[model samples]
Target: MEIEAISRTYSPEMACVIFCCRVFIKTAAAEDLEQFVAYGDIDWNEVYRLAALHRVRPIVYRVLNNTNIPEPTLTRFRNYCRALSVFAFERQIESARIKQVLGQQGISVRMYKGLDFTKVVYGGDISLREFTDMDMMIAPGQLSAMVNVMKAEGYVCSQVEYLRRFPTNFVTNKKDICFYKRSPMGRLFGFEFHYRPTNFMMDQSPGFDELLGKDSSPFTHEQYYRLMVLNHGASDYYPNLRSLVDIVMLSQGRVVDVPPKLRRYERLGQELASRLLNSPAPAVPADKPLLKCATLITEWQLTATPRSGWEKMYMHIRFSSSFLHTLRLMLRAMHYFALPNEKDINNVQLPLFKLYYLAKPVRLLNIPSRLKKVFS
Candidate 1:
């Protein structure tokens, strides 16, 4: 769809977001944005909120700093981008220190996601991307050694106590662990150590060895794009414009041979991007229900609309490729909620594991209230 068509179909806030976040805006799109800004009645506050929710505030600021937005809103975006630059610099320093510490122990680390994309895709402008933690992939066999090295370097793992008590169980079930430490300057840095790129059920998904290579080289653009697609599916399409934007940015000018099992998600992502970001539509048509649910969820996220628990579950189930996949996802979700995390145990003081598992449902009754608080 063209920019003008999107502006007509969606709100002006969404239209501006789509225009500002395109990977490569054509002359026609730029003219459309100018015309929309000149004539369309736009709510600058809603645009700012949407940009922040979509995690594309930096990109929006870069594209619209010279536009006729209110001064206060532009200043807010400018300050946010500046703070992100400082945080990115601190993370870079901390990441280097982590690599040195782990390298001394013979652990080969390959960074991925925002840490790598900020440099490779965004041309080293880390402010353009928002990421909470640095993702590092390591060999599965070296998990114990890696944890010990991180702990020795004063980094604390989030599940340290739980892992200590149930090392085998945790390692067998979970794919990653997060470790955090405060820098000397009082800045906190987080790193997620992953043994795998994604937890998708697709058999064609690449493993750590294939992604890292025998010599532990960096991932090629193709490998990274494959991971991004799997991750989008693994996350149930994530219900955000940034998720689709990442896919578009990575697949630009590239031929990504998505596996047959994961093509539906790729198609849905492409469809959403095409509708919102003016990217070319997918050659294959998307699943109608999945696309509709994804579109609704994305719009709700942009508007800060509260969603019911049933809606969330329905969205997750609709992302499944088949009935069997939906069943597996349902079972996995059940198991996840049943297993008591450290926070749950800390809050409840349960004595028996079976009791904790039994009480999980009762504990989840507060989730609605929590959601209300979040969206209030």
Candidate 2:
């Protein structure tokens, strides 16, 4: 409902106060409300109902323009968030210990996804980012041994069974080998053991090792930070304003002599921010959508680079126009029948290559019609 309509019932001054409170709580949690209110002259009673409503509200708008709330009220707003922070901190401490222990066993384990995310994004440890458990990335060959090591340290492998057609989900705990009833929520988070990140994509790219070979020095926390930010953008950045705020936090603290290794990462972050601004995706607020997206894009592009053929392909597909998305495979298919991608000494100019690529979807559309005539 419009603020004006709602204001008719309450005092205009009270309505204005409530509106300000809503804006504050938009980004600042209820625990932080007091500090935010200190800046304004509004009384607690004036905003109590508003804050109460905020606690119960569904956070309908995923994006917001600005937040003026104080930081103090954040803790009081929700226990779930506080629980999340405690869980993350404990998990990080545990994971770090596990890493050290596993290293001594001749089994090197690399931390992946969430733990790395907390490390890189907050600059040291963002225990406040509300992560559940820890996820470590180990080589597929090393998974059995790694699992055993974890099991000895109070973690039992989790087993939730779903049909094979569905994408895999796993959570291992200290009690059971697998718990179909328990989610990966707060217990033992998912550890997606992958030799390569590119394996999950539409096209196989060069593995993480290939990228590491080409100057993997700044490949610690900052690398993870860039990945999470980009992944969030791709996923439309679900349910959490704090996730986007984490991007803002990660972008800070580089005013002095910036490292050359992170230059590419910084550029990528900038590009993400710019592109998000340009598209103004569904989750972005209209007021600062472009600005936020552009900022994120710029920071990401600064750190990430295409390392393999698969990486290159992913980049091309992800950044390509819609037309490229539909026709890329078709062009590959037609290479067998038409012209070659190689540079011949004669340099034959066969325009059919372009024609075939362009007509891919149309050809797909005709298949049904052709079948109908045969059936008739």
Candidate 3:
């Protein structure tokens, strides 16, 4: 019965309901089971057994918050929350260290995820949000140099085979998650330097010089700070409620002085938030529209909860297969969330689709002629 009570708190059409219920079953806390039976007349024991197969912490939190479960089940949720808090706190420390390191090197680094999030979201302290990487933006030409600096400090580039070797298109499509394992303390500390934003798929994105100009403008540091928050949530499509909250908290009463043209970008930020609270899960087609699915996923991640576990798994599959597909999906998902419309959907056309497609297959054959064409 308590399960029924818990289920009533969320949307009937929630894509993760089944997944959430599975988490409930895992606790196998008898008080939760008894409450479920008393309220729903359903077999709680069997459901708990089945839920063991899933790993849905978000759902588990929701159940404990919504249902009349036993104090022990509540205690388990509290413990989970405490652990996440500790993890998040450590991530903040790591982010601060990275900022300090970049400052020492005169690299002009700006924080995007991690500890910067604390200033954005309400209840961010207790929300089920965590940052795994300290994403910092560096100048375009300085990418290799920055990597070199990190490597000098014991950071290593990822060698996942596909990522080990990059093509001409890679710089435009993928942002490498460079890892730094600094002896013992460094093992727990790694930094991600993004030469390109997730919205690099945009046909008219500004260049590094433009970003520098905007950042260095006469506007106060607070205005630039707000701009970064909007850019991260809307452009990068970071998936977490706390991200929006970060923008809200950091930009509070500080957006009045933003440049006029830059303010236009805020529309996308607003759209991202609206989409999150409204339609969290959107049904999209496969194949030609794979980009559409990806954009939706990105939107949800930035604005709402992740699109769904299925969406995340699907993207992981597609991205692993092709770098071009990875970029395509990133672009499509962004458009779907930031600027969704049927007419807008019909106009989606990625310029590099053909060149990347043709180039990748020929490279695999090791054909001298086709390879020559690619390089030539």
For residues 28-102, could you state the per-residue lDDT of candidate 2 as single tens digits?
A: 344333343345454434333342332221121111113443333332334444555666676677668778998
Model 1 residue pairs with clashes: none
Could you tell me which 10 consecutive residues in candidate 1 have the lowest summed lDDT?
23-32
Better of 1 and 2 by TM-score: 1
Score each candidate by Cα lDDT. 0.72, 0.40, 0.46
Report the Cα lDDT for residue 178, model 2.
23
Q: In angstroms, how far off is 2's CA in candidate 1?
A: 5.0
Estimate TM-scores for all models: 0.84, 0.44, 0.49
Q: Tell me the tens digit of each residue's lDDT in model 1 across 82-163.
A: 9899998888878888888888889988777766777877767787888789888776677778889988889897676656
Ranking of all predicted structures according to lDDT, beginning with the best and ending with the worst: 1, 3, 2
TM-score of 3: 0.49
lDDT of 3 by residue, 167-211 (tens): 333455555446656535333666777765444333355443444
